[model samples]
Target: MSGSEIVGDIAEGALLARAVEPAAGEAPDGHTQETACLNCGTTLCGSHCHSCGQAAHVHKTLAAFFHDLLHGVFHFEGKIWRTLPLLVWRPGLLTREYIDGRRASYVSPIALFLFVVFLTFALFNLAVGPIHVEPSAVIAAKSGGVQAEADAARELATTEARLARARRGAADRRSGKRTGVRS
Candidate 1:
């Protein structure tokens, strides 16, 4: 048979074998059996169980999905808090130290940067609301600069009107009530 036909035959054979031996350690949905903790052999409860710290997780479980989501979101599982102060005070000391290969002891700089960014965004959302904005835009929008400008224009108009009235009074004095000019 041709290579394509041979490959197709092999795939059919494998599918037949899978259908025949469905319970040979495969879940109905194709998931493999869950493994217990290596150290304690107890069925792990979740990612790092309370009993033996075994990660009782499969890639497809709802709980595992949520666990990963929460881990990504909160991010301070332990390392973020430890590294932040050092990052702020020491500056490139972190980048330098990490680059030197003394790695196993701290959060990765990328991870730390992500954590800070997530924290800043979370705090910003909590403080502001659903709407996203720059602080400068928000401040500029709230400030009364437009109203102030309008007030200034009104004031200029008022001053001009007052100056006109004063000029009219002076003209009346000059023409009608004249100071006697004896040449």
Candidate 2:
């Protein structure tokens, strides 16, 4: 593969990973539990134990892991769905709200990008209409955009061939030999 293709793959992988992962410090259970008591030795529960204000609970389960995973995905999807309509129409509202820390109400950028990419590719493949056009003036017009690139490539090849001939002639002159000439 080309360098750009490799780079693109890496970038795509990174973006997908970002979309799949949860943000840092975002509590899975929306609550933090304390490990130990300050005044007396007591097992903590729910932010505080009524006796002291300490954190509560910790994540420790396979179910909890999967739950957090689903939570992240659905949370992101929910935000995207809510923000997408307004984003498509207003545009400014989504940006402003996001900048103003209304992030909880909207999908993150990476998530939205991934979702959009996935949807676009899926829809494109599933689309049944005129996916392939018959060869005609319309098709020619569509291809005309690439005509200049083809012309440039032809010109480059011609120039390179001319340069090669010139180099060969120069080498013959330096060696005092006549090329392509009968004795």
In order, how many clashes per candidate? Answer: 1, 6
Ten-residue region with minimum lDDT total, candidate 1: 52-61
Error of 2 at 125 (Å): 2.3
Best by lDDT: 2
- Tens digits of per-residue lDDT, candidate 1, 64-164, equal 54665565555546656656777789858766755543333356555565767888999988998788589999788767788789899999999999999
Model 2 Cα lDDT, one tens digit per residue, 20-93 = 76462366564334455432335655454445432234334446656644554556644567877988998898
Q: Which ten residues in a row have the lowest lDDT in candidate 2?
A: 52-61
Predicted structure with the largest TM-score when compared to the true one = 2
Per-model TM against the reference: 0.31, 0.32
Q: Any runs in candidate 2 off by more than 4 Å, and if so which?
A: 1-74, 128-183
lDDT computed for candidate 1: 0.63
Error of 1 at 83 (Å): 1.6
The segments of candidate 1 whose C-alpha lies over 4 angstroms from its true place after superposition are: 1-77, 132-183
